[model samples]
Target: MSGRQGAAISRDGTFDAFDLCARRATLEGIVDATTLPRMADGVADEGGLARVAWRIEGTSDALGRPALEIGLDGIVPLECQRCLAPFEGPVAQRTLLLLARDERELARLDGEAEHEVVLASVPLDALELVEDELLLTLPFAPRCERPECVGAATAAGAAEERTSAFGALAGLKPAPKNE
Candidate 1:
């Protein structure tokens, strides 16, 4: 593991995938959540600061294909869809990406469906890859699963106790048949 910690990787920095794999190099760093614009859009508030730690290593997959293993862990503030409240959610993900040498090879590997296949575009944007993985890990509809949140939702629902809009229509009866 390389000691390239504390925002060592710039947003535009690129890495040669082939060389990294050959050397089996590992890079790890920390990035501010605010720096990731796309990820900020998914969170509840952009004002709060969050730190995301990431690690990437170049190696070979079980099938002997060049690959990159990525790991990310962080906490992000998210809005609860159930109670409409803000809460902190944990994010952790690990993925193995197989690299294909060319477009033709990418298409062929994509059909396997057993592993994630990506084009080994020389000088790959490492920061962009980290951001992409973070976005993918976010919940589509974030909901606070805590017991307090659940209780609050139940209490609010009971307090409102709204009658159904079609309740009056249910009371109507069919008209008697004309003689």
Candidate 2:
């Protein structure tokens, strides 16, 4: 059966942390980027479909905390930062979020220089989880990957037209030496 054959799960229909971990639950779904309110703005107004896969399995991370691994595969249309033209970019994101039950543990993990952990309540919204991962996968300043792009207007010409703020300020005079 298709992973999404069942009725759509609501934000209130909760998943049991214990059952998920015990059964190693796996779920899949499709998200039309154009319809997701929180994420619609980030993608182009054109075609955008996301295939999502997620899993929650038993792990020693802790109890009362949901450790979810999310995988995202899709293509998002983005405007090139250099050329200001639109292009399709491939996205494949896989991440592990270590959730902490209390502030103490959250703080401890935050203080660590290596990994990140979130403080989330159990029975969290499943669709929200998928949306969060998708949002995180977008590029901050998307640029086309075409090799021809290197010396094209998107790259060289644009760089030549825009100067750093500091560079622009460097031309200032010293007020006639304050004489």
Candidate 3:
């Protein structure tokens, strides 16, 4: 949880809904994904901030017949697949996340399935969701900016070895014929 930080959710599970009701919302808190419900290192040199945003349509769940939507945007450092260098990039996505309280309510949410949104029994840890998405977005191999990278060095070495092998074969030729 090094350099970990994020907003606090009240015990009653309420935050200012209005604050995040704009076309875009900027949350200032380091949501230490290490502190999320379930998390692990899928690859090496993985870590950083996972900022989130909520684009509410109607209102918070506390409001009767309330309907809301959320969107997430942030960046995390990921190791490059090609060169194994670290790079910071965006992790942005928009989806429907339900805040319903029971399975019955969750099923009802499915009625709005065309929305492709999420239905949850509890208040979602917004930061955690963003963190997980960002982690999953990481590339399989990390590459560096330098054209002549560590991988290139290895390639050069392999080419030299092949050339030496060919030189040995050239020496085993038949003798020249005379008139």
Candidate 4:
């Protein structure tokens, strides 16, 4: 694939994960979800910007595996399952990604790897990485965060109907000893 610029450095250029890890590079920038199709599809409004910050740790983990620390922050417009209304949900995540040369290496490190293992590819696609992280952080059940929302109240009480079947059956049994 053709190379891109910005956090996603051109592959022909100096964008290899190995080099980045060696140099301990840090990239801090704002990426547009509007630019990432997969991310854009899930957003209620594709106009929001994603703030991504990543640092390649020169040092390896206990397993001697290269790792990158990434953080993301953005407001994702999504439909609230609670209220069935559109709301801005805060998105944030920070995780360490362990970089491996190939699937074999990744598999070897699976048990000992303290962080998520990823295949280290050339011309690292920073934008794709950012989008993937953001997509994973998306709220599984988007809902209005407000405590007083009617939807929240209804959902809270919805479980009240759940009762122990044995308890209900006991109530139905007459108090025979009362006679």
Candidate maximizing lDDT: 1
Lowest summed lDDT across 10 adjacent residues in model 3 is found at 1-10
* Candidate 2: worst-modelled 10 consecutive residues by lDDT: 1-10
For model 3, the stretches where C-alpha displacement exceeds 4 angstroms are 1-8, 11-28, 32-65, 111-113, 116-123, 132-179
Q: What is the C-alpha RMSD of each candidate to the true structure, in Å?
A: 4.4, 5.3, 10.6, 6.3
The alpha-carbon lDDT assigned to residue 46 of candidate 1 equals 41
TM-score of each: 0.79, 0.67, 0.44, 0.69
Tell me the tens digit of each residue's lDDT in model 3 across 33-115: 43444434533344555333333332334333344454545554556665666666455665444445567876777787654
Residue pairs with backbone atoms closer than 3 Å in model 1 (clashes): none
lDDT of candidate 1 over 57-164, digit per residue (tens): 888999888998988888878888887788888878998888989999999989988878778776777777888888888888889888988898888877666444
115: Cα error in model 3, Å: 3.3
Given candidate 1, what's the lDDT at residue 39? 73
In model 1, how large is the Cα lDDT of residue 177? 88
Q: What C-alpha lDDT, on a 0 to 100 scale, does residue 138 get in candidate 1?
A: 82
Q: What is the lDDT of residue 87 in candidate 4?
A: 73
For candidate 3, the per-residue lDDT at 53 reads 39
- Candidate 4 lDDT (Cα, 0 to 1): 0.65
Candidate 2: regions farther than 4 A off? 1-14, 48-66, 153-179
Of the two candidates 2 and 4, the one with more favorable TM-score, higher being better, is 4
